[model samples]
Target: MGIDDRAPGRPRSREADAAILDAALELLIERGAVATSIEQVARRAGVTRATVYRRFPDKAQLLIATIEAAYGDPPPTQEIRDVEHLLTGWASILASPRLRRLLRRLYGAIEDFPEIARAYQRMLGQQRDQARRNVFERARDRGQFPPDTDSDVLLDLLTGAGWQHLAIQPDNCTVEDTERFLRAVLHQAGYRPDGYRQQLVPQGQQPARPGDKE
Candidate 1:
């Protein structure tokens, strides 16, 4: 798409949609949620403001759409084939500098751009949480966690651990390290898959016992 070649009428092709979404994502990562506007995205996308608005309607929706596109497939909900699958997916995402920066921007927007937060919760949070809950329940069924274990609490714990790594320790984050950390948290929380030591613990390293220092 040329600088002046705006698609007329409604967006009719995947090219236009991809261009718009890609431009929006780039601007969001570069300028953040507050500074990025439909006009800027339209210009960057080589489409008109009307073209962008016809797809997104508003900035909140546009930003959320960009984020969801970045998340890719299988999404958090569909990626939960098992505990390992879930943790690995999260570790990969958290280890990404781009995604980490994007998340930080969104975190900042919670107070400044409340609409974005609301849109994110509605569009992504609920389904992701439910998928995680299902994973926890499956773990319980397999005796990784006790029958009485509370999936909600486990979910909160794991989610908090991930955010702490993403937000509080981005400079030191790595996929291997994040995976190990999440596995340690799960081990400490009474999660023990079959052959837990073989699968999770590194060679000759003692698994974290309950009540041990975090």
Candidate 2:
């Protein structure tokens, strides 16, 4: 039977969904993606294995859903403004130590369990990339970047900067600190949004420099 097949108008159990996702996240963090299984999650969540299987046919989808939950409510594609918006969102997510650990594990899984990565890409990657590309295209039109700037490479670099922050910075890194680092990266990349002044720098605050006291 399909996962969505239920009595007409019956509400899906939010409590059950929360338990299952929480259980799956704990397992993934503890054992990595390779060792986490629906059986294990079901036992931990105190639900039947069939319950998890109904919601997620396979492990990849379950893991992806867990990661998506970690992200909280994502902004609609239409609300993705320029690089500043992206940086703010990225910094907010990186500020969470729990999410940082989850992301680290997922990053490691890219090589060992490529299918999960592929599944995520198929589900969410293309849509997010297109939104970012639109941001870049608008920036180009506004003359913030050179017309020839390649959004793909720019996107890659920006993404790598976030990961580097995650991998390098201490778990206690502040959201303000993270945003400063992200803005510095965008500034370096010539991403100056049309502003009154300061070029992405906050009023009266100089751009953050490498090794500056945070």
Candidate 3:
């Protein structure tokens, strides 16, 4: 939307909405939470402060919405048919430059906007956790993991691998290396990748190791 767009409380235009969210996200990543404000967003968006506040009601809500807009929704886990699907999808997200920086911005802004950061992280984390849980359940039912597998424990290991690469060790490992590490870690965590035989382990027992082929 150009300057002199429709006033707030009027029939809002998608153009204006897009512009406002885009500008807010840019400022959030560039200057971080404390530096980003409705006034600044309005100025950068070429919309009025009333437009922003009327759209968002508060700074926290505005910033959160901006983040959601940038990243969109987490991929659904129910669609994942196997461990390969799960790991590859996660690899894509973990290796994303956009997501890497977004996590950085969220933590960086946490000190300034504790409530907002917490709220956003909770929203994002819940969706991610749910997705992971679905994949784990699927893999378990298909015998991709041992029958006795603790899904949540396995998830923690996988999640930590992604978190370490994205937030803590972005420089220490390249994207390809990070993805490879995740696959390796998933194997160690008892995920038998697709195409491997699903040798269903008995309940309350560890998975079987590979046996030599005849």
Best by TM-score: 2
TM-score of each: 0.81, 0.82, 0.77
Candidate 3 Cα errors over 4 Å, as ranges: 1-4, 7-10, 73-82, 121-124, 167-176, 195-207, 211-214
From the highest lDDT down, the ranking of the candidates is: 2, 1, 3
Worst lDDT run of 10 residues, candidate 3, spans 205-214
lDDT of 3 by residue, 1-214 (tens): 5553665556767878898998998888788888888999999999888778778898888888887677674343245665676777667666677667776777677686798867765756566677678778778787676677887898888877776776566643455676688888877766665424646778996444554243
lDDT of 3 at 146: 69
lDDT of 2 at 161: 92
Off by over 4 Å in 1: 1-11, 73-79, 195-214
Q: Where does candidate 1 have its weakest 10-residue lDDT segment? A: 2-11
Per-residue C-alpha lDDT of model 2 across residues 9-115, encoded as one tens digit per residue: 67877777998899999999888999899999988888778778878999999999888776774643536877777778889888889888888899989998899
Ranked candidates, highest TM-score first: 2, 1, 3
Query: What TM-score quantifies how close candidate 2 is to the native fold?
Result: 0.82
Looking at model 3, residue 102 earns an lDDT score of 70
Query: For model 3, which pairs clash?
Result: none
Model 1 clashes, total count: 0
Write down the lDDT of every candidate, Cα atoms only. 0.81, 0.82, 0.73
